[model samples]
Target: MAKPARIRLAGTIAATALCAAAATEAAAQTPPDDSIVLNQQLQLGDVFSHQTLNVVDAQEQVTVSTSAQGNSASGAVENGSITVQSDQDMRGDAVAGTDMTFGGDTWGVVNATTQAQGNYLAVSAYDSDLTVDATQSNTGSLVSATSQLGDDDARLLGGAYINASAISNTVAMYGEGSFVGGTIDQSSSATVRAYNRIETQYIPAEAVIDSQAIVNAVQVTSGQTSGQNLAIVQTSTGAFVEAESSANSGNAWDLAGRARATANQAVLYNEGGSVVADSRQDNTAFVRAAATTTAFDFGRAEAHARGAANELSIGNNDIYVEIDNSQFNSGGVDVTATFSGANGYDVYVGADAVGNSVIGYSCSDCGGYLEARNSQTNDGDVSARADTTVAGSTRAVITGANSVGNSATFHVSRPSH
Candidate 1:
């Protein structure tokens, strides 16, 4: 009986110990939903003196990771200041389904990452006498960041950085001092808008920059613009344009290898400049005077129109050209420059028709007019009363098949009653 009692007691003690261990494990496995919420708003008042931590929080649907592994740091967020001496590195990442918002500021070193769909991110950083960096990569998304620096000096770099294939993204930078040394690179097919209004700087090769407006001193670039529109470049003191093109075709404003503009009349100037408009189709070039006191001044304006069966036409304006050289083909109407200001002028020299076809027109006034099928090249007669002297002759040249060409050519001829 004594032996049995001892054995029973031993069994009872072993069972109690097993039950205690199981209870301990059950308590430890409780969900950490509340702890995660508290850490989200955690702040440090000051010096984190020699505190080592490797924390990992992984939940079923979401996760928050915080790590610090290196030296000396001092900074503040919402009146909370933290200073760390001797090696410190921090990394925090969050992932979810709907959206994610992230923020950080480090005097030591920091790295952050996030992944989600249909999200927005706004991050900022300030560093003193230290190096700061940020990187991001995403698709079908949008991101924006703004950073500032103090006198101590800070550097920021970004990579592949922002990708939003089917969305729009904006990145802006503002600085009080200067870019002592830093770089920002952003690339995407989707539209990107960057505003850098620094005093003056240099932008070298394949650097794409777009802003609604820019005020700068010097710029060097090789660029191209298409689509029928207007390109306005404004400078307070002076403006310059040096350009060259291969071809321009189709429409009322097809400025192929040309430079033109409209401006105030009082102080109009075009020094050491050239404007060339080549019209290779029917009624291809026309200039309209937007102002009444039209002061036209062109330095070295040479307009050329050449090719089989092409025509160049000009309209109402005051034009003063230092050197004007116009070229045309046998089946092409070389020059047709005309103005109708009670005092308009005409300066042109070339064929009267294109291959057996004659171009003619009859006009009672500017408002009432009727043109012939072949009159596209016909320079019939010009009648005008103006204060300025006008000198030019209208003639017909038989470059088309002489056997098939017709001509009742007349210059300044009014039919007699």
Candidate 2:
């Protein structure tokens, strides 16, 4: 649950020396050892390595996220490699809601959120990565909140949200709980509340979310994920990977909802309200919990909607909202591979991977997809895979292998309503 970054000039600085002063501060903040710590110091923010770290902490209790709640919203782009690392043996507020990145093999990352008080919020991405990462033990909470007030004839909306994406880049994140996810909920509602318990997914080229689109008096929430989990990894591109033998990762996404856009509304009084939630996660990038090790990550979503109240309420009232959670862990190899390669020959994947599987499946409210496969024996492109419910979890497991290693159990819980 990261917020939009807070950037303000406290004291006045000579504009002429701003560059020199900033450089000096960045240099002084470098870690003595290769190890680093990312902490959010209460309400004032934290002091950290500015050169290698980039954070986005934005909060709008009144209106909009980091976007235009009326029309369209977008994210910026980076042109170099980057690395995100967090070391926490204990699962406290070591590095709560924050984003930090250094230079490396990966390039470009985006974290975006939006709300539409007029119609519906639209989300799309291209040539970059959009996701959320979480790794925790014992217990933790990550939350994001957005709000909309007043009344209008914007009760329900309709449309198609995405098309295609372009790109070229790599990514890597290491720590206790590692997770990567991109989700969108589009279920129509009517009975004063909309229901969104369906996920229509397809990955002929890349892992994507495309469902029915609409806007209305609907509120959506996600990620109230909780569980015990763990992930240990050791990956590299050298000759061979030598170390242990057991590797494991667990992950989850809970998509539950329902929506009704056009229903019987006795406008004489009111038209009710609409609510939705999607893809809740519970896991970490790296860590060792006291009670368990099989780190867990989760994401939950639901939606309810209806048409604008006609002459009933003297007028019509409508609210539209949309959201998605993005994440990734590895050399940006496991998950990024699924998003980049069109040929499907994940050439760089190596070793005995436990919970590093890409699940691109969806079902109606009645069915689910849960599967777990062990490839450590032969160990093909990847190591393991599982098909559970929309309530999916991502846990990592690494053996002694040649590549980048990441162990995580991240609970990236950010609910916006």
Candidate 3:
């Protein structure tokens, strides 16, 4: 009718330019020996009106590659928001070959009544010569509220690797929140090789009326076998709180390690409140080895009219090597506390061990205050152990080497005036 409708719109624009030139020559080739490669990006913004609310953003990226032998590569990202002002960023990458495997992941969220912020990053790399296994992971979260006030922030980073001959590496990070006054930070780092195994972690909880929950974590590894490294931070508040965890290792043999920091506070009319927890570990081992490090710091405070005070700490340190038939085993520092109103308290626990055959323990409780400390040192046929328990009003003190299959127990209930 009009010249055959202009030849059917010129054959649908020449088949959409030959399907966008075959998707740009299959994204410029290179990834085909039993192949798989992927790339992804997503962004969403726009939803406002509740007395002028604006600015919501999201971003993501993923890349993957695989070659032969049951090949696999994966990348993922998810982001969310409800805003007066909110921001988010996510990144991921994966590569594999020769009995190949790779995975990268990222998740993010932002809910703002006034302001919110988030950032997440993930990287995975494995180029095999055969026998290559690799994994990388990252997680994130953020929330903010302001009727006339603002601020909220979150960050996470992960890295994984396998560069030849028996490689297994893993890195992890996690975050959580609820804010009315802002300020929160979480961190993670990891490296792996040689009898490969490495882990890094951060756990977060925040309830802000005046805001504060900050955490920093670090993990590293290379060469000389054996594995395990952990860091944990827990927080709850009506006011102030702080937490910390630090770990280091190399040349490890049969090692189990831990670091924990915790805080809890409740204030209705405010009389005073503060809480802190810190854990640290350093390791080197050989000669029939076993190494254990535990550091736990806990705090609790509650106030209705007057008195409210709490502080707790735990520290364990080890440097290893026990020869002459070898066998160096050490577990040091454990501290715990539980407290209730109308004040009256002080508690501390400490344990230390060094070289040639050692074992140790330390415990503490406040609310009927209690303390325990144990230590061991040097040479062959060396042994030291201690245990203490106090329900209320029990006191203990013990010192060093050959406490001869040691034991100490105490229980006291206070309510007799």
Candidate 4:
């Protein structure tokens, strides 16, 4: 009774409906062992997990978390084009342009996000580590990451613009073991901005016996240079060293070292290094923006020798400091000895020469012996009266209202050494 054209049309509709049902059932099954190749299009539900996704060789489009999971959703277009409607947390490695919008928290450990030419962003990790360990043949640009390590003994290494919010507290034995080690080299620029605090637990025997710890922060900016830019050392016996441009580069060295509440029992040495500003031009080297370029800064080169019979040496034309903010044992002779700087400023030179400058002031509660030399060309201003002492040696040029030039004066008593 039906026409031939109508019969054919009915059969086509039935076939299409059956195919759609079958596809839905297939998606509900376990994740595909191989790659989820979609030549046309594919849509997924709210949950996606326990799957290793490889998008490097994909030319198709696949969307996940369409509707809404709780109050948020996530879907990725290309490598970097990942979008999230609400707050979401992603834990894994994603390529460039994996656009992500999280209304909550993200933690990243051993993850790599490379931004070839466009913009990129990454966030948090639990036990995962994010590594951006690229070679000299690679070029990375416009990459931004905000990361936090929530588990103990976790590490995050590599890349630029990296924000590390936390370090682990678990005990582990290995060389160069820190909660975080961010290494950005080979013409790389890294900026670590954080709003939270990073904590690390102390290991007694392993830390106390180690002579020197290569423990510091690596942070560099603007110029292309090798090694670390910023270095921060928190625990154990280690030296926090940061180096920028070379002294012979004819340019100002962009190097800085900052520390607070760092406890250690370490021995450090500065063999024959010099911190010289380009006397050729009005260039600036070893400067403090908090003070300015011309303030004649102190402690550009610092040494922390805080143990029994420890020694700290500073070369000529170097800034050295020894901050004593640790719980030291009694009868332990922690020495902070400084060599003179270049230009005859070695240990506070005369008006014609730039000698070493000593600035020591202690509160009444701070109990330590304060000694200074070459106060004649400089003034020894002591505010606290806790029996301070400044003994000028035979080879030492001691002055002030008390010695050499009327420039050196020390109110603290000293035993004639």
Q: Which candidate number maximizes lDDT?
A: 3
lDDT of 1 by residue, 331-371 (tens): 21221212111112222111121211222222223222222
The number of residue pairs in model 3 that clash at the backbone is 0
C-alpha root-mean-square deviation, each candidate: 30.9, 27.7, 24.9, 26.3
Clashes of each: 12, 135, 0, 52
> Candidate 3 residues 159-201, lDDT tens each?
2121111001112211111101111122211111011112212
- Point out the higher-scoring one by lDDT: 2 or 3: 3
Model 1 lDDT, full chain set? 0.18
Flag regions of model 4 displaced more than 4 Å: 1-5, 28-417
TM-score of each: 0.15, 0.18, 0.19, 0.19
Q: How far is candidate 1 from the true structure (C-alpha RMSD, Å)?
A: 30.9
Runs in model 3 lying further than 4 Å from the true structure: 1-27, 31-122, 127-417
For model 1, where is the 10-residue window of minimal lDDT?
286-295
Weakest ten-residue segment in model 3 by summed lDDT: 265-274
lDDT of each: 0.18, 0.18, 0.20, 0.18
* CA deviation > 4 Å runs, candidate 1: 1-7, 19-38, 44-196, 201-417
In angstroms, how far off is 291's CA in candidate 3? 25
